[model samples]
Target: MARGKEQPARRGGGGRAIGRVIPWAVIGLWVAAVAVLAPFAAGLDKVKSDKVVDYLPSGAESTTVAALEEKLPGGGVNDFVVVYYRAAGITADDRTTAERHLAVLDRKYPGPPTDSAPPSIPAGENGPHTVGADGDKTTGSSSRVQDSRDGKALLFAHSVGTASGEPSAYLPALRKLLEDRPAGLEAKVTGPGAIEGDIDAVFDGIDAKLMITTVIVVTVLLILIYRSPVLWLLPLLAVGCAALISMAAVHLLAKNFGVVVNEQSAAVLVILVFGVGTDYALLIVARYREVLQTEADTNRAMSVALRSAGPAIIASAGTVAAGLLCLLAADLNSTSGLGPVGAVGVACALIAMLTLFPALLLVLGRWVFWPKVPKVLPAGVTGAVAGQARWDRLGAWIDRRKGLAAFGSVVFLGAVALGLLGGPGSLRSQDQFVKTPESVSGFTLVTRHFPHIGGQPITVIAPTAKKDAVLEAAEAVKGVSQVVPGRSGAEYAEITVFPKDAPDSPAERRTLKALRAAVDKVEPAAAVGGPSAQNLDTATTSARDEKIVIPLVLVVITLILGALLRAVAAPVVLILTVVVSFAAAIGASTLVFEHIFGFKGIDPGLPLLGFLFLVALGVDYNIFLMHRAREESLLHGTRRGILGSLSATGGVITSAGVVLAATFAVLATLPLVPMAELGFLVAFGVLLDTLLVRSILVPAVGLRLGSRLWWPSALGRHTDPEDADGQASVPIGRERALRN
Candidate 1:
């Protein structure tokens, strides 16, 4: 008998040793993965493109113009204006200096060589400079230089071949050429090339700046939430690993599959990884802490924690990933690309938190909690009683006034939602920068000095046979200042229509609308496109995508909730509450945007992108609540279950919310207007959902419905409230202890 007992004891010890080895093995594997991926991840920013055509809908007229322009004689071009300004007037010396600058530009970057070029290329295409019959460069007649009506601005139209490479490369040289301006003359390079350069300069620091800000925000919030210096660092380190892995995945996808990534998408990726990953970490750690208060073995406690919290974390990640993938259906390339990029970030976060985080916590054992470490309680003393008393009382209070709570919450949310009625309009290009860059300032100067001359002209493509009719109709449009015929291909002809108003002004949009209508009447095959047209298409497509994607996301999330909760009524109610929360968030954000922040209009894609993030992420808190409630309902029935789950999960979920909101809030610190607006809206919306909708409104609804909230499931049939309270009030591990 003694020999048999010894063998059994030895087997048990070996089993324990294997369990200890597993967690370290998992950590080692992840460390190796990160080491291998760090190099590729660092290169993700180098591949981002800021080209406008890259973001436009493939079917849009502007996109078509870009494609056709690429096939032209010089293989596409970058056209911009060199504006020489003087407060008083253009002096003789200014004119002389300008002529000399133009001559140097023509000689250095001359247009395509002409041997009386093909029909595809317009004649006299010796490039930006004029060439004599002898094939020699002419002096100063290369580019078309015009003087503003007020004589304070001198505008020179410069076009460079893009076949060579990115036109933005020429900006540095152009800036250098303009550096030696005449005294008292302000020479600003204001055009597509210059604007692109400024935008690129800002994007150069996006990854580092966004990462530092996000890490700082998350660390501060974590320290406050955990109140344990050591505990907070674990989640931050895990999230950093997730971010690195996410960046590598995105880079690989972009390289292998031609995925489009812009600076905006890349920055948002870092925020999502840190925010969502930390939220998952909080949920797991909270459960682990609770288990530690009852279980003696650290490994057993971790196993129990993972078992309880794993489903909720997975479900939360699923809803967000599915909702983001819906962006693939979007017509806008930038919005579509963001869908995969964000989905990858969320997926990587989930993987890291689920595997790496739990492994780390288990490896560190009970001491990870430090000074506040939970001590295993004595027999019959449950962990649930003291920790959940406050939540229990609040749940009881809301249950008593369920009717009032429901009505009051709706009234308040609806009142806040009225702010959407103001119609903030669409964001214009001039307002795209938070603080105006030099390109914008130069454009402004040009507008002031050249009031009669159009800055960026509207480009129209028509069938070659209908060129004259297209030109006549275009010129006859109300706000058109001039119609200049451009190069004609075999099938199509390009015409540049200069508008009387500024390029992105409301008046110009109207003018573009009228011009399209008129040109289409005479030349049915004609298409009008330019900077203004691109903006119009973006707004229209965004509105359409909102209608389609919102309904799909609601349906998808509802199914996920229903499947997870195993109850139809609860899922329906949860969906309804989240929708209301989204509306309230938008309404509240709109008020702050217009009244407090002084924003005139929002980005065209803001409503759709904001809705996607708010609804998907907002539903996460509800999932955390309802998932735990469902588990408790199995033993405690629906009423007590709701109260118990809320009490238990309240602190952690709230901490998670604040962490997420703070991470998103970091976007406001960036100089980009769209990012700032998105950050504010998402951050505000998340807070509203956390503080009001999830905490009060959802609980109130659940209380009023009671067991009926679990309809179509056995839990819906009310059980003895006294029996459930007596049994479930015991800490989870205590029942097993009593049995032992």
Candidate 2:
């Protein structure tokens, strides 16, 4: 580096004053913003809903039933089935104990008991029917106690009005009523309502847990990456600021615009902001350090860093936000709600990192990098160190054996993809939790003692005039064991059908379809809905959403890359690598779920969510690499530029990737199966993209294309030696000239 190449250590009086004042001004603005928004952020949880109806597809029959249920005289109902059992078989004493528990429930949780409440078994049926606490037929009451033929279990089925609130609010007290059961009888509450209660309980303190854990994980990793106890705080602080802004923004959207924010989306929002905000910090810091080696003025160094690295950072954020926003197209409420929530988070992160983060860095100055603070170097001396030598050599080798590198990378990704041999299986509600709750245990017990009767009811709402035809059609379904008439409303009537198979069983699904078809023919206005039907609709709707959203996300990202890189070929190559990496990640995750974690099956929506994350976040590293490569290629030839860019960015990009992966891996701490599975897949996919896809395959492809990699761009053609001559003395890594 020559002296002429160095930027002046001091600037004009006006420039210096403005530069000094700008940082403080930016800091003040952020403080005010945080002070104003913190309250709303704290209120974010108030708007979140985790109800089953909230997550189901908007137009699904189950969703419609849930909406219509609210319109019935006593429509909003929570149904519970309490199971009492003794392995030795229910003795006469056990029956008495069960009846006492039923009496307690009836007295404590008794609803107004409208026609819309779940019906009791008809008299003289083959199976056991519910009897009142005094052993008489319980008519027009919400509680019913039935015994199993095996003489080992007793089931007390009941309904309560949902007017109080979600089942979670009152179910705990109801379950507590059963805690004093006789020692010989094992009592547990299980049913659709109880299962939902358990789920809500799992997410009770999830945000706090995820926030504390994520902050700790990111803090530790940042400390290690920066190697300075004090230095790591800056990025973390900036990310916290971003988190507050995002939380507030999301809360407003959810409160005012009817955006769906569930526990899962809220949890994920935290991880995304932290992971992505920290990533932007890493890239900016690396560029700032690079600029500081030549420009002594902190302001000038920051300006140069932002000018050079800011486009990639913006593009990275845009790509991720755009990809997430594509989720708006999903039919599932939870899935669609996540789109804007995540996009807002990413946008907030971008705003904070690009604005507040840089200002904080400038205010702190070189001390921010204290232990190994970058120093100004002589004009002809570069910042390249021995650690970067490996990347230069690797780049040269990749260039020399481009074909082999590409082939090996493809083969490796494909091999990992072999885990998809057995398709990602469908997850059942019972398996949705990593640890079994009492609801699951109770459901299992009920199924064991009453295998012939479905433990869950399939609800059918039909026009009052066609109730008889719908009932006959529902009973005609192959897997249906009984069709019980339910309360009649002004326009519609309820018909409860019991399937012979379990709710999650294949036979139940078949029966659901057949029942829907049969009823549709008899009464077009009739809708088949219930816990089982909800599961079926969610799976099918999620599959449909994947087809629509994934392709849109791909196009959105490619266009972002094309505009940022200003090149077609490079963007296409990067997109391809990201897509392949996504597939491999999904494949590997499927195997891990089935074998390592022992998850029963994958969530139907996991693939779409995983694809969005892997592609958007995975392409982030390539944007940093290729953007730098494009800048360098204009000066040096494409071969040397690619090598130099690789050497320069390889360290920072890998660090960013590790940070992201670690943040997402935090998701595994959650008890929900879907969150854990998603966290693992994204984490694994990120590492794959950084370590192999970006590091080797992408660079190799770029090197093979040479200057032509920037098709349609001026840099794609011959570079003007005179233009290159102005910076011929621009210092680069000594090994960057490695033979190709």
Best by TM-score: 2
Candidate 1: residue 113 lDDT (0-100): 38
What lDDT does each candidate get?
0.79, 0.84
Worst lDDT run of 10 residues, candidate 2, spans: 731-740
Clashing pairs in 2: 1-379, 1-380, 2-379
How close to the true structure is residue 431 of candidate 1, measured as C-alpha lDDT?
68
Q: Can you write out model 2's per-residue Cα lDDT over 556-645, one digit (the tens) per residue?
A: 999999898777888898999898898888888888898888999888889999999999999889999998887777556677778889
Candidate 1 ranges beyond 4 A from true positions: 1-11, 109-143, 163-168, 384-390, 463-466, 489-492, 521-526, 719-740
Candidate 1: minimum summed lDDT over ten consecutive residues — where? 115-124
Candidate 1 lDDT tens digits, 392-473: 7778887788778889998999998887888567887666777887778888887786676653677888888998999998
